[model samples]
Target: MSVRPPGECTAPDRRCILVIATVASFLTPFMSSSINIALPVIGAEFATDAVLLGWIQTAYLLASAICLVPFGRLADIHGMKKIFLTGITIFTLSTLLCGLSPTVNALIALRMVQGVGTAMIAVTAVAVLTAVFPAGERGRVLGINVAAVYTGLSMGPFLGGVLTQHLGWRSIFLVTVPLGLIAVALTLRARGEWSTPRDERFDLIGSVVYGTTLLALMYGLTLLPEATGFGLIAVGVVGIFLFLWQESHTESPVLQVRLFFENHVFTFSNIAALINYSATFAVSFLLSLYLQYNRGLDPQAAGLILLAQPVVQALISPAAGRLSDRVEPRIVSSVGMTLSAAGLALLTVLTEETPVPYILISLVVLGTGYALFSSPNTNAIMSSVEKRYYGVASATLATSRQVGMMLSMGIVMMIFSVVIGRVAITPAEHAPLLSSINLAFMLFAALCVVGIFFSLARGRVREDPHRA
Candidate 1:
């Protein structure tokens, strides 16, 4: 468990690794974004309720959140390339099965499996990128990685709409198969492998406790306003305390508990990430429904409209990343958080009669803010850690993201459960749905406003001696 560099690699090896990681990065977000567009269609085809439709997304995120930390530790101990390749193979095959799923239940099950693959890819890609690149180049490289993610998001809505309209929702999953295969094939050809040379045993007991606790917490959130939900949440809170105690005593903890307490930059930066994602991840989910159900737009039209935010995100992320290389990342990210809050505030007034241009303008603002925040924030977190912690660090950051996403959706599902009930999105249900969306926006905007402080409080990453 002593500190050291994970491994070394040549320039060519760096290039190959980046390509594989970027491709893998692009894969998950594309499916996630596209699937949002396909949700209405999927719901109709299955004759399911709104809460059930929300579960389609929740199941995948829950599974990912549960596994991310464990897989990340495995990557650090075993080998990044081995885990990365396996993840791609699992994701691609599971995606195909998801497309062929016979029922809603089957689709949700497969999505959980797909999420396990996502957990493997999510934790390792950044760790691999960090392993190959030096400190000076970290921001630029990570920016490109973030850009690839936004690019997948950019294509998802437009292409997902087209596929759903023409071929059905299944086509959205089927089309990603080729790209996943390409990443796998290229990974096989890459010769470099990286891992921390540690003899520490994997913390199986800690992993189990962590996963089960997170599951209870997330599931409880979705079932809010109910007695069972409150009871489960209380159990989750107690489990968290137990998990922390277990980690502190264990020789090889799955999560490094001290990182949150001892490391100033890592702790606040991760909290900022958690808050930022919690505030922003549901914008598209709410907007897609707003455009289609309330405004009566077709999936294609709604998608084209919803495409604005991620398109701006994809466009600006690299530049923002490069900017972070020069400026203080906290400063850059804090401003972005402010802008995101402003955008969310604007959306709080959305209605059936709200002008299309106003909604588009709000999306543009959110996109700009997100682009500004994401890469710099990522650079800060990655730069704060030593090379040996890269895999766990990456996993920790990804865990924040996945957990935030679950929280964002959990807010929506809870609101839906209370306001709109378990009904389908028929015209009679439109008023309640609109109210739910606006209320969610109000809560999210407040969360973003609170996150700005954490972003600024992370202090300076460049000052950290371990940055190299």
Candidate 2:
């Protein structure tokens, strides 16, 4: 499958790709955010503690982060549509199995498989979009795709809450099955596939080292305050360095290491994404518990309250993405990061006495910042790379997100281990839980403040067309 230049592709072809990408984009985030609303119910049903409950999300993120790059490279070597179809099948089946999981352990395991499926879809969806659309129109389509993501996020809490409240937590996972089938049906009808022209051997050794090290690092983060955790983190860090060195020597690497050192826009944009997601990803997770346990709200009401952020994001993303095409992405994204810092800072003061309106106000601020940051930053990343590297670039973007989400959860898990310990969210543990949530928000605010610098440091995307 030789690649088609952006100008050469037909409008209908672009529309088909966008439809597939949009559905895929919506599906994964919907599952993730909806599950956040169901965590309390899941914990209650299974009689699990906070740390174990965190694993429900963390395990999926870890698996997706581990597989994204390898599967992305495979897509580059083979075909995006083939991998995309396979992923949809895997995701649909795994999601079905997840709903049937009788134990928390079984559910967690299935989520890992679901994550693997997610990795394939995550890597290809954006790459395919970038592949079909011209650079001038990239941000517009990317914004639309990103808006779809926010739509899923916005719906996740409300729909997830309704399903969880009325139909049980299992319904939240089961409902996605029909949507998955629809995506598969649409994708199968799409014509042609995309792949890199170059033929290179896959680097088996680098993939193993990369996967192993990341697993160790993320798992270690969850086990924090323990000497074993520190030891494993040290090993993971060292192993990553070794993996990079191996990539430099390998004939064909899973990750193209040179992209980071050579491309300022790519590197800093990715860094900004890491920091932004790290600061913001766990906001819903913490608040879901806070609303249910601390504020004594039902899942339905809590979800409506939680919908403020992503709704703002869904509304603003396309405009911001289009704006980035005209202005400097760094400037627009930096301002967004600043807003995020402000939002997270507001949440740091949250307590049982805090008003619901205050929380909603803070969420609106955070969502605005996220809306500004995500689309333009993504536009910068995809635009900075050449067509041949789209799969890798897309996967790198998704990997940054998964790793950031994993770290966000890791931060929460470590805090839980230390502040709340391995305890259920009984009224007895409420005080400690509040303390933990407040402290986490404080750290996240500080992190977002730092991310503003990186967002600016990514420089101008339009000027630095090094490869694009």
Candidate 3:
């Protein structure tokens, strides 16, 4: 689909796209973050160890990471509306299956399917919004869409905890079914499908190689500090070289590997995104454990305490998005990264005796920093790439975010293996847990420091004329 000039689109059509994007955006994060609060409950019910329990989250993300790029390409070749609706249907059905799952293994399998659907929705949503909105309004629309993500995150904990506490963890999935249906309804109410006109063949080999590469890399990250894990990491690194070679030689690549080497703005922006998510994604996971297990708070209290970060993100993201339209996104994004580093550095010192107020303040700082960073950074990335690459570009950025999240979880899991062994988290293990959390934060903080440089190094972004 060619980019629609801003004014050429009917106002109703713009609203329809934005509304569908916003609603669809909310479902994934809400489900993910809310599920984070319920992890302890799920783990206990399943009688599974932490490593296995981690798969509940990892499997979905892994599946999404593997499929997003290919699905994005598919959307461009087929139609975004068809892919988006199919994803919504599959995700809703899988969510119901998840709620009914009698076993952890079953749930994990369902989640993997859910992840495939998520990949479809995630990539297509960005492609559609960028396609319909004009350049001048791009940042603002992207910001609003991003804010919906944060809003979902913010609501997930408190609402999820309430449902988990009252109706059991299963209710969380049930509740989302309605929301998913609503999104589907809104999307159906919208008029037409958006997709680039194309006849290019799908690169099946490249897709397989790309998927396998991510699966190996993410799995390796989870097994870190183990000798075998190091071997796996080596294998994954080799896979990367192979994937790149294939992409270069393929007639039509699923991912334009050349962009990473050739497009300075795109490369640095994606790297910056990876760093930012790697540094930040694990915050709530660590904190939920810290609050509930170490600090002796219940799930409800823990959820409330964890709510501060995304709440700030929810509040500030749209404004930051609007700001990026007028100023350089890198300037805004670099400052945000610096602030995130500061917030994370402060968090590294957290102990059992740390005051609640201090923790909340740290969360606020981190949240504020993230809020400023995410939307602007996203705007920079989407704005940097050409219109033809929109689906791939969107998928690439989303993939970086998911991959970084997997890495974040891997870092935490590795620390858990080293610090606490395979035991279930106990009060006796709180000190080691603190050590793990602190270690994760320190690593994350350092990553943010590096991220700020990448944020700056992205060349001055040329405004996308497709939008203009």
Candidate 4:
């Protein structure tokens, strides 16, 4: 086993570093979904179509995926602190620009820049935390970090709705400015050190090629429902091939395709993550509309109701992580995914007149399942790689997550568009919209079922085993 050098600080100091890193990680998801509640208002203001509206979220996901690998490598080359601070600065500035954007085009452009900043922070966070914490404590520290992420995701809708209703949608972006400054201050105060600079070089060509490929594929996916022309298919197929070729030949490939082949644990964890996230993305995105349009819930009520999932997730994640440290991650992850799929299946019976209690129960079940699944699953992924390669490993996992989310959004939108197109009426008409959302939920459940299979396939590894 290859044991990397521990962090410079003592255990207590390392704990502090974990706290700081967790806080920084929170910014990404908080910003990502907080904007969802505001999309309607923004869409109306900009006269954006459904297809163009999708870009608001897609731009962020695409940019983040494109930048994660390169930023991770940069963290290894220079220092995590330098790259992290730069990212925070950029994120804060771009958020301000987003708040002030006068047009849809400008807002989309600024969001892409914001996503770059988010990617930098996100890609570095897990590596930094792993470096600070000892192997034995890694699972707990990561669990807390995961909890923070879910907390942010849970709070996003409520915050967004409240702010948009009272303070205007722009306030959502404005609020992050101070939080960003606070995070920067804390990071500076934290104590941790990296090794001396090595003779490493960034793979600029690989980064560009990978970025272009992901952009093309994501764009094609986004456009597929509206424009099912041959051009979209051609772009997706060609882009995917080029991406594969680039990764195969590059000396320092961005994605580390070899790792996927050699490590069964890594492969299954990524597959499970992708499937789980796709289901999550579909449910959250569609449910927001379902609550508001079909059930006559206001944005604030809808947000509050959605909070059920994250609240339970926060409650159960630590326990799940601790359990994984004792048992096989495959068992924990498989059971969790199964529970989540069941919860989503329950949602298939939802109707416009469904009781609020039933909806909350379903959400709680989903949240519990997610909490159980996420921490253990992430622990498996992070533990599989050598400590020195934590940066790349974490980046790959994060990229998988973003890709899943982006794909889920695209697929859900496509399905919704098709379902709605068959009806000669607007989405504001309750019955047709409810039917569409029901179908979407059923599709999401099916994806979760696939996650269960992948989770089961993740062969057992010694929990927190020494890395090579």
Please name the candidate that would achieve the greatest lDDT relative to the true structure. 2
Runs with alpha carbons beyond 4 Å of true place in candidate 3: 1-19, 130-144, 185-192, 462-468
| Per-model TM-score versus the true fold | 0.92, 0.92, 0.90, 0.87
Task: For residues 1-468, write the lDDT of model 3, one tens digit per residue.
Answer: 464333465769888889888988999999889988888788778866566667788888889888888988888777788899989888989999999999999999999999998988998887788777878888789778877887898899999889988899899999899888888888788766664546889989989988888887777766777877888888889988999999999888898887787678888999999999989998988888788767888778888988999888888877998899899999999989999999999999999899999999999999989988988898888787777766567678888999888888877777777777777655676788889899989999999999999999986775433331
Order of candidate numbers by lDDT, starting with the best: 2, 1, 3, 4
Superposition-based RMSD of candidate 4 using all C-alpha atoms, in angstroms: 4.1
Model 3, poorest ten-residue lDDT window? 459-468
Q: What do the candidate models score in CA lDDT, each in turn? A: 0.88, 0.89, 0.85, 0.77
* Residue 258 error, candidate 1, Å: 0.5
Look at candidate 3 and tell me the lDDT of residue 10: 72
Worst 10 residues of 1 by lDDT: 1-10
Clashing pairs in 3: 1-195, 1-196, 135-467
Clashes of 4: 0
Superposed Cα deviation of residue 317, candidate 3 (Å)? 2.0
Tens-digit lDDT track of model 1 for 1-468: 433344466678778878988999999999999899888889889987788888888889889889988988787677777788899999999999999999998999999999999999988887778777888888688878877887899988999988998899999999899988999898888775655545669999989999989888877877888999888889899989999999999988999887877789999999999999999998888898888889988888888988999999878887887899999999999999999999999999998999999999999999999999998998899899887776567778888999999888888888889898877788888899899999999999999999999999888899976575
- Candidate 4 residue spans exceeding 4 A from truth: 1-20, 132-144, 185-195, 225-230, 421-432, 463-468
> Model 3 scores what on Cα lDDT?
0.85
lDDT of 2 by residue, 368-398 (tens): 9998999899889988988777667777888
